[model samples]
Target: GAGVSQSPSNKVTEKGKDVELRCDPISGHTALYWYRQRLGQGLEFLIYFQGNSAPDKSGLPSDRFSAERTGESVSTLTIQRTQQEDSAVYLCASSRDSYTGELFFGEGSRLTVL
Candidate 1:
C-alpha cells in the first residue's frame, strides 16, 4: 500500500499569498495528522483527524491555518495570507489507530514565502 502522499512538494510565494497543501493517507489507516517543520526545527503538530470524530485543531499556529479531511482518507491544509513566518515544510502522517505510537509520514511540501 502507498504511504502518505503530499502534493506540490515545493512552493514559493510572495507574502500575503494563500497556499493549499494536500495529503492522501495510506489505505485502511484511520488516523491522519498534519505537521509543520520550519527549517532546522522539529516537527510541529498542526492537526489530527481520526475516523469520523471531530478533528483535533489545537495545534494550529494561528487563524491563518486550517485543514479538513474527507472520507477519512484525503486531507488538505490551507494557509491564508501566507507570511514569511509560515514558510516551512508541511508534513502529513497516518497511523492504523489514533492511540498508536507509530506514524508513517509523507515527504513534506516545502513552502517558501518571500
Candidate 2:
C-alpha cells in the first residue's frame, strides 16, 4: 500500500483477553508512530520509532501496552490483559523522518473491550 496500512480494522475482545494490532507503514518512511483516541477524545501519542534509534515510549498509558517496529517497516501494538478502559481506536502513522511533521495515517484499528 502507498499509505500506512493497519489490520483488524475492528476488534472485539473480552476483558482480560490480549489483543494485537498491526501496522505497515509506507515503504520508505523512516518514522512510525502509534496513537490512541478514546471516545470523544483527542489523539494521544503512544510510541514513536525512527530508524535504529531507541523508540520513545513516554506516552504509553500503562505497562500493559507495548509496541515493536522492525526496521522501518511493520509495527505491532500489543495490549495484555485488556480492560474496558483500553477500548479505543489505535492509529498508526508514518513520515519521511522524525522531523517531517507530515504523517500518513492508517484507517486505524478500533478495539472494543467487553
Candidate 3:
C-alpha cells in the first residue's frame, strides 16, 4: 500500500462483542499510533509504538483495549467486551519517527456498538 492502510472501513458489532482493527503503515515508518474519536468529539490517543522500544499504552481507556505491532509493518487494535461508549472511529497514524511530528493516517475503522 502506498499509504497507511486500515481494514474493515466500517464495523458494526453488538454490545459485549469483540472487535479487531488492523493497520498497515508506510514502509520504513517507525512510529505507529492508535486513537479513538467519539461522535462529535476530538481524537483521543490510545497507544503508541516506536520501533523496538516499549509501546506507550498510557492512553488506553481500559484494560479491555490492547494493541500489537510486528516490527514496523502491521498493527492491530483489539477491543474486548465492547460497550456503547466504544462506538467511535479507530484511527491509525504512522510517522518516520516519533520526532518527525508529521504523520500519515489511514481512512480509519468506524466501530458501531449497538
List lDDT for all candidates, in order.
0.90, 0.92, 0.92
Tens-digit lDDT track for model 1 on 29-90?
99998999989999999988897454679999999998888877888899999999998999
Local lDDT at 68 for model 3: 89
Cα deviation at 84, candidate 3, in Å, is 0.6
Model 2, which residues run further than 4 Å from truth? none
Superposed by TM-score, candidate 1 places the C-alpha of residue 28 at a distance from the truth, in angstroms, of 0.8
The better candidate by lDDT, 1 or 2, is 2
Model 2 lDDT per residue over 1-114, tens place = 688899999999999999999999999999999999998899999989896354578899899998888877899999999999999999999999989699999999999999
TM-score of each: 0.94, 0.96, 0.96
Candidate 2 matches the true fold with a TM-score of 0.96
lDDT of 3: 0.92
Indicate the residue-level lDDT of 4 in model 2.
88
Per-residue CA lDDT of model 3 for 1-114, tens digit only, reads 689999989999999999999999999999999889998899999999997454578899999998989988899999999999999999999999999899899999999999
